[model samples]
Target chain A: MASDDTPAIRLAGLRKRYGTGDAAVDALKGVDMTVHAGEVVGLIGPSGSGKTTLLKCLGAVIEPTGGRMELAGEAIYDAERGGWQVGDLRALRRDRIGFVFQAPYLIPFLDVTDNVALLPMLAGVANGAARKRALALLTALDVAHRAGAQVSQLSGGEQQRVAIARALANRAPVILADEPTAPLDSERALTVVRILNEMAVQYRTAIIVVTHDEKIIPTFRRIYHIRDGVTHEEAGEGRPV
Target chain B: MAGVYRGMVDDGQVLIDNSGADLWVVQQGTLGPYAEPSSIRDDVWRGIAGIHGVAETGNAAYLTMQIKQGGHEARVMVVGIEVDRPGRPGAPPYLTFGRPILQGHYEAIADEKTGLKLGERVRIRRHEYVVVGLTRRMVSSSGDPMIFVPLKDAQEIQFLKDNDALINERARTAANPAFNRPGVPGLLEAAQASATQARNVNAVLVRLAPDVDPDTVAGEIRRWKRLTAYTRAQMEDILVAKLIATSAKQIGMFLVILSVVTAAIVAFIIYTMTLAKVREIAVLKLIGAKNRTIAAMILQQALGLGLIGFLVGRVAAGLWGPAFPKYVLLVPGDALRGFAIVMAICALASLVAIRAALRIDPAEAIGG
Candidate 1:
């Protein structure tokens, strides 16, 4: 288990460039950031400010042109981990990281319970056991009554919560939420932020919430605003609505 | 035994049939639906009853003709049976709707495939017979409706012509220079009338005793050398394997084409549906859903769609098959085989969509 003092994610001197020569365009110049356990941090940046690019690198979705990435005290990508000899990068992504998108992209055919249970089931857990864990999480989130309901039947906020439950289903140490509150009202956005904080504290998980929403901006005590692929850290307002 | 029996009867040694069995004795060289055509004494059942185990027998008839319906003329075989008398071998095994002919002159029984309603009338060989009864799955060698009529009526249709043609024929014969000279023109008409009445039958039906072996009786009939006989089992085999064999193959070919078309349609539908969810799939990948899991989901959906489609197609085939002029027999075993085939096609169809989804990059979801 990763403790609160241990950093769940670390990026050092990260750089990413698309194409080469005349068509070359650098997406990430150099990024340095550390998100420790039990901390829900905001990533605030303008559109195309390399916020997505940096997030991709930090999430290990895209390989960096140059840098080191460490998650949960293990160095996943470095000067040495980068050689062309590795057999699989997909397996690495599946086992280590979790993601929550801007929209609650629940599978429509599945019910609310199975939508959250799907991640654990994908990890080879038995269906009954995965569903059991899903129900437990749903109960904790106070949405257990809707477990049998189809995902299409759930409201937007409820659907986002189900998506969040899905992100945490595998019990990964790090969660990257991409504009998770983008479609919500101010109260719902703050509710999601508060939920993320409680989940991080309870699960000892590190969370990075990438957003441009101002309503929940002050809820995060720590913030990383990126520009031109460079990130600068600042203490958030820490104000309660 | 039929030849020997016939010999004894010709020699005035025995009475009608004392043997009891259910059988179809056809023409020499013509097995049931085969090459030869057989004619028997119309009242042979009376003799057949005197044998050993005949409960009862009836004259069942079959011949090919062209029927005009819905403005399209199609060549079809007309199977005539006596439905007025129940418990006869020639009667339909079951009735679907309406009453049996039961001694009605113009009433007839028609298979559902002939597009005849229970109360409809059909013109067979210039005689309008009312369809008072209906049967199911009763077809001839060439997939035609077996129309059950009274033995007398079927005989009329088989041999008798219209009043004008009969009169013309009698006049032509009466005008024959060798027979008439000049004294009697209508005199020959009376003689031709008697000749027309002697039209007997094309086959003999033998119903055997329950315990008696039909194989032995068939062998006996063949020994008579002047006739042919078909046991029940042999008749069914001839009907399904030889008579309808080519037709079965034709429908089988249609089945193959339909299977392929179904597979292609399912693949296209599933592939298109999957493409619509590319972003969701990529996000799923980035969020750590396994490739196999996603593949299984797509596969299951394809299979589910095929299952529903198969149900609809089968029900549609059944509901509308009777409207066709030719017989369309949808057997239960055929339905089961079709279901298995549909599932296999569905499984194969999903592979294309699965491969497409597997190739989606998780990075795409993150960057966009």
Candidate 2:
């Protein structure tokens, strides 16, 4: 587990604007946020509320217009520099961040085990070791019996579990899950939230889940709500899954 | 197409290789009997034999004509060699059936490709000859199968005219006033007899002694005997570069066009396949997959498709090769070169797909 004082992710006065000259639109306005180790938080927002823009900035898929951002105790982006602190955002994303989409979106060609093993493989782990790590994660997620099955053979809930397994395959410091339970039933949705909370504590990783699912909303200890282009942090009910 | 050209080019070489001779002596100012008509006196081999470094010499007559058998007719190059002695330079290199021509006048050894059965009677200009033996791989520069007969019969067939033409020529000779002078005695009869008889052969095949240079002997033949002589390599050049140069060029143009079309097709297919996976590619990029990883995936697929195409093409060619009118020479060197070219083309074709995959924005994987 990480030391108590260190944060897994931090952002201060992050701003992003699209285009320029009279046509510019600010997607994120002075967004300030922080996520600590071994924590699971919720992010709820209305349509076009800069929720996706904030996630993109955090995932390193897009550069912020202005901001000071830190990940895993290291400064990554700053407004004064007007750019990223690191040279290769791709490497940072691969080594330090994980993501889960609304859809499971597992690679169809790869079997379940390879779907998880692929991250470590990309990180240059030997095939044997990568597969072993993938098997352990599958077992932890309770989908180990389907490890050798094709993605198409997996059910919706099973596929989501496999996706979570893949996100944790590299043991990244932070995970940004966008609507991780949008298609699940109430029972399955709570199960997914429970698994996410368990994974966060077990791996000492911070997880920020973006969702509109009312069924899984009360499971977070804290929630960040965004409107227009700004975010407001608040305490959650912290209901046990 | 290239195989057929190779076969035509090799036809001339096949002839030279079969003869096993070091030099070919023909009439002055000619490219030898195979490329042009060159009729030298039948006894020229005697003078060539007397040359230093010359081990042996044999007379060879090549006459390409249509021969009739039963109700079928086939064009064949009738080669007249010394049948009295076996294993001569002009003889068929090997016989697949029956015996060599023991009685020279009406017996022949025909290449198997001619479709002539043993003991089948084939009518030439004015004589009926029986096929006594069968050989293989003996063909003319134009890919016509060869029919090996005695040197005497080939000369007769090459020089003799039909009976009507012969009669007309005798009468024309007798009526010429210069020969029919009042007291010419037997001069008219002698002239007719001389005109009817043929005393020329096409060329002479020359074999040199060990440690002798073929070019040196060819130089001596050209300088002393006043005859055109060609070494093996020079003859090959005339046959390959001169005889089939135009056809080779045409085949080369066809191959270039074929390669372009194949590359275009491969590129389009790979590009389409890559485009079909746009969403998957976006997801991969979002997950931090390298650009090279996506590129390698498309490239490997293209190469695999090319390998399958090559295997199917090779099998089809092999199955239909013998059915072609000309021999199709499918050598291992050509097959290997073709495989390498296909792989190169496949790799090049995948570049477009790789570029498109690289351009996919990782942000697309997340909704706005």
Candidate 3:
């Protein structure tokens, strides 16, 4: 642990199942981990290895079978209350969480600025204010020059970065990246990892990158590996490369 | 209702009298009363002209019933007007063929609907009259042909009798003989009076000056009680609302039902479309987008589809309006109202799809 302060995320006994009886399939089995703020961690697993299930539970995208998960010193999952939030979980995610995916699924109709601004606007921020915030983030992310461009016009890397800017638009304290560099070249993949690391340190964000990308695995000092619904923790070579 | 009667109006441009005045002064509650057997006294125009502001008046007769003209028999509204003074109000706004009844004696004008060619001779009630001119689209309110005839001849045709019936009536009077005075020439007076009165007609037609208030004189005519009169505006209202009110109501009900049906169709379509994109919607849901945002996007798209359909329908209806039989009156206001209703229906219809979209679980995108 880097500091005595509470970690940005704490998880214990996380489990997931699709159905009951003989057809049941357990995806996550009692996983436990802790990641402090300003750290970029990797979740590596093979196909069908519960990596996606864990990410979903972390993002509030799905309910866990049984778990105690906390975010930013707040209890998020209690199997007793059913891992679902009592009210609008969507609002919780929009204000406090961010997500990055394998492909950049930007809204084709809106420009890059608007794509980033859309979340804040949905959260009651005025259009102008939201755009200003989005512009600042895009400038920080190096995609500000292409603010006016439509999503279709951006190159793959630019799109990926724009999507990253969109993810950080609300300045969420946590980000969950799933195979974000899968479609990029080797250089682009490392560039994306470097950008994720810089963003985590700059924003004091806790980022969880789920990947099968072996090239970037050694870059994370802390890595969690899971196989057949069970996870094991390991420390990687503590080097930026 | 007028859509059903569009055939006749499409074919006519003829107005019986171009210089006719403002008021039609029909029977108080009638307009082209073409579906019923109705008539007023021939001399009704004399009193109407005597009214203040009534610039000129003339006798006009209208009979709407089954009439045999040429070799064909169909329901026609026969309007008899004098060649001078005021033109008949029921004359159509357009003329596609020959001129209106601007000719002198023995002239007749027929709607293209009646299939009467120019200069054709037709016999009505045994009175031979020449169709000197052809006219287009002179339709009665009930969607029937309006045949313009010379006033005197129309009166005579309407009044003309069979010789045997007239002779029989004469025989009955002669046989009645109260005094049986030989020098009295028994049947002569009764027969002559009956013959003379038979040619006298049903009602008068009056046209007032443009600036005159027709309602005032119309009120005066109503006071006479024996005669009834209607102004031009009143006549159009009566024709549209009163005369065709029942059919209009029927069509209105159909339109309402069609709108509801269309709304249901739209809702189902939007729902189906949303369901097809369930995974996509789930992804959007998981990404922290609010339900209202997703709902609005679907609603806007549904409205866009409605707007497109309406434009296509309006254009289709307009292009096909002319080829219909009878009269199809596609009023501008009706189209505007239709557009408004379409929009409302689209909005209401989108609600179903929105609800379905909102219900999608965000976890579906993850799918354990």
Q: Which whole-number lDDT from 0 to 100 does residue B18 have in model 1? A: 13
Interface RMSD of candidate number 3: 2.2
Please list the Cα RMSD from the true structure of every candidate, rounded to 1 decimal place: 8.1, 3.6, 6.7
Mind giving the per-residue lDDT tens digits that candidate 3 earns over B134-192?
66556666567777777776676676667887777666656665534467774467555
Candidate 1 chain B minimal-lDDT segment of 10 residues: B11-20
| Model 1 TM | 0.77
TM-score per candidate, chains pooled? 0.77, 0.87, 0.71
Worst 10 residues of 2 chain A by lDDT: A1-10
The full ranking of all candidates by TM-score, starting with the best, is: 2, 1, 3
In order, what lDDT does every prediction score? 0.74, 0.90, 0.75
- lDDT of candidate 1 vs native? 0.74
- Considering the two chains of model 1, state its CAPRI-style docking category: acceptable
Instruction: Give one digit per residue, the lDDT tens place, for model 1 in A1-241.
Output: 6555768888888888999999988887878889988788999898888888887876677778887878876677785566222345655555566788888878888899988898887778899999999998888777899999998888988998888888788888888899998899988888888888888888878899999998998888899989887889999987754
Clash counts for the predictions, in order: 30, 0, 19
- lDDT per residue as tens, model 3, A1-241: 2254788888888899989999999999899988888899999988899998998889887789898888877778888776654466887788888888787777766899998998788778899999999999899889899999999899999999988888888888889898998899988888899989889989989999999887888889899998988888899875674
Candidate rank order under lDDT: 2, 3, 1
> Which docking class does model 3 fall in?
acceptable
> Hey, what RMSD does candidate 1 come out at?
8.1
Candidate 2 per-residue lDDT over residues A124-189, each given as its tens digit: 989999999999999999999999999999999999999999999999989999998998999988
After superposition, the stretches of candidate 1 with alpha carbons farther than 4 Å from their true spots are A1-4, A81-95, A124-129, A139-142, B1-23, B31-153, B181-197, B207-225, B310-335
Candidate 2's displacement at residue A239, Å, is 7.3
